[model samples]
Target: MFREANSTLVDREWRIAEVCQRLEHDLEVLGVTAIEDRLQDGVPETIYTLRKAGINFWMLTGDKQNTAIQIALSCNFISPEPKGQLLLIDGKTEEEVGRSLERVLLTMRTTASEPKDVAFVIDGWALEIALKHYWKAFTELAILSRTAICCRVTPSQKAQLVQILKSCDYRTLAIGDGGNDVRMIQQADIGVGISGREGLQAARAADYSIGRFRFLRRLILVHGRYSYNRTAFLSQYSFYKSLLICFIQIFFSFISGVSGTSLFNSVSLMAYNVFYTSIPVLVSVLDKDLSEETVMQHPQILFYCQAGRLLNPSTFAGWFGRSLFHAVVVFVISIHAYAFEKSEMEEVGMVALSGCIWLQAFVVTLETNSFTILQHLAIWGNLIAFYVINWIVCAIPSSGMYTIMFRLCGQPSYWLTILLMVAAGMGPILAIKYFRYTYRPSKINTLQQAERLGGPISVSREYRATTTTDRERSCSIINHSTEEQKPSLRTSSFRFS
Candidate 1:
């Protein structure tokens, strides 16, 4: 056993492949049918791809090192020449990728050209973030490193590897067709899951998944280069823009309140809340949406950075424009209503404003993934809560002092106002996204599968994945597939990249 490239899944795999080839090859030669079948089934696609690419590959399965080489040779995945490029990695034992990360960091001194803020994924396998600033220190640490796959790795180590890669300013995409790849898949820039007997976690975490790993070649070579920075920018920009619109409405709302008259009859505060706030958020969510799995997979710092991108000219302009538009429209309509006593036309103006603001908001995130997933949840949650609170304050007509402060009169206009508000609120978001991602009870449960597959529920604590009879039961997913398979491959489809 020598060194692991970087990722633990690969690390563990190196060992497993070693044992499988050694034991299975000998057993097969001895005519053991079951062992032969297992070895064939366990053959992972990674080895084949690397072989095709003419990259170096090896494993020190406990079988004779020559036998290990022989198995690789039989697969047509090994070079005929015994060049120094081929080194045997002992797969039976788990080994640390580095001795001390602090020491590694010391080697990577921050510099103007190679910033310390960035992290790099060394050798594409280990879970360590080597600061570019400290490359020298990292080199020193490397000098004293142990071979990977001394046998097992923790999930935290997997996450650390991703963080390190990000720091290096490299977009690392992870691919796995089995349960072993779940943690790494969740950490990569993009994860390509392949459906296999290993289970659904890989498929669920991945940006794309296929029945076979070969399809992943297309995704990595193609869309992997697509820039998400723009998408991220627009997403945060849309959210800021919505808030700006609300602020404009609020300012005008205050003016009206102070003057004891409506400042803008273009749209009522309630109408604005419905369309400008609620509808924009919902539609933007659906139209600009990405998989929730994606959001969860990334580090929170990535979102913060993306949100910062919203500070740019285009983003700021969009936000300012929408907010200013609301303020102007409301102010203009209020003056008109005052002179003409056109309060009766509040409905018309409200409807028009709703159509405009909602559409704008929906289009805003069309550049970003519905402004990222967790954000969608927050925006929708806030918007819906706004409506519920509005109704609670305005609709009830109690015959008490309590209702005196909160409830509006039971007039036909007020009832109609509420209905119009609903229409306006729902209009814009719906305009852009005709199709959306939907979840059904019939889908298979990956969490349950993870628990059943002997996966650690809490890796940091200890191994309890398959400790007892409490292990979860096996079940089938009635109907579910990749996010791409859903109606929304991309609705608004906005990305800065």
Candidate 2:
């Protein structure tokens, strides 16, 4: 083969034939060479966790079908039960591939009555045929099967699969530990790289990297879920805080005769972002509300991610309405209580600024459920910093801007105005909270109602008509807040009367 390459530059066929001929007779097996690649510790448990989390696992590898099947079995990607069926599809021609795929699709359609778990295994060549000629049928089979594994796939094919799923509007996550997986990882919505013997090429390209595959469970269930929730809350809260400030300024503008001057001093404005409001959000981002044991015990919490129950348009609107209400209360109460002299624009501005800052901090504090020592420090530290900055800015020389604009700092009335503003701004919010907590339906009573009706019940006619027992099992997960025994799966209609 080497001589032919150097001399005639043989074609691929001749090269392959020559290599096979040489290996056929001269290569005597001195000993059977065995290489075993053991599964990473906790991989099986992780797979089980992901499965319960409603995440589908697909194995795309360059290995032979049988080897892939063995690996899949060992990793618990495929259940070991005898009821499970592995459908392998491969052929020398496109026609043969089409027939095999049709058979799998037929089995899937008929299997609901028999209730047999089925997995589909397809090779690169067969996948190419299915994708080109029988795309719709193949997609149906992929969706219907309990699990799907694609063997002998090139890197491009892996990328293609990820792209296909993404095109279907699925939030795909591709995790791999090798150079060959870079394209697929990059193609996914979130890419996770596993740091193992395979290489760092994939890790370098991924959004997150982990030392072991098992950590993926925590990365998705705990960190991913929490991160999403925190980010949503942070986004809405940040908007609300800014909107409150802007609305206060807008309200002051009417009295100031359309003057474009800022209601708060420059130092106070800077402190708002840098000192007053930074820590609450920082603490919020790191807060872990649900315990690891709680999350692991109820894997259905994972389904909430798909439904986007945490942050949506309704939540954003609610935040905006709340902010508008608080802004109105702070503006109206501060002006009515403290703006006795129309000539004292500076005093009014001071009261408004202080009121806004205090109310903003108060609202942030309200959102916090349970606080660690550090979080408590962060929240209190922001308030202390605001006061210290306020005093320092007021103590500056007469030529200084703060000294000129904010002259009400030493007045006891100024502080009293701020105290009244806090009470006024927080009154309605506290009332709403207290009312909800006091009048909220008991979870125990709701569960009793559900049991009385039957299994999980939905009042919406559409939901009742569409929902099946299997779907109820899949959708029902832990409700993070309520102590009810039933899964807190969201329904289209209100569950309680």
Cand. 1 TM to true fold = 0.37
* Per-candidate total of colliding backbone pairs: 44, 0
Local distance difference test scores for all models? 0.38, 0.68
Tens digits of lDDT, candidate 2, 206-288: 89988766677788888887887788889999898889888888987898788888777666676677777877778877676
What overall lDDT, based on C-alpha atoms, would model 1 receive against the true structure?
0.38
In model 2, the runs with Cα more than 4 Å from the true position are: 1-31, 106-117, 140-146, 255-257, 341-343, 397-420, 427-497
Worst 10 residues of 1 by lDDT: 473-482
* Per-residue lDDT of model 1, residues 27-89, tens digit only: 435354332211222233533432232112212122333433444444433444543123222
Error of 2 at 143 (Å): 4.6
Cα RMSD to the true fold for all candidates:
18.2, 10.2
Error of 1 at 91 (Å): 18
Clashing pairs in 2: none
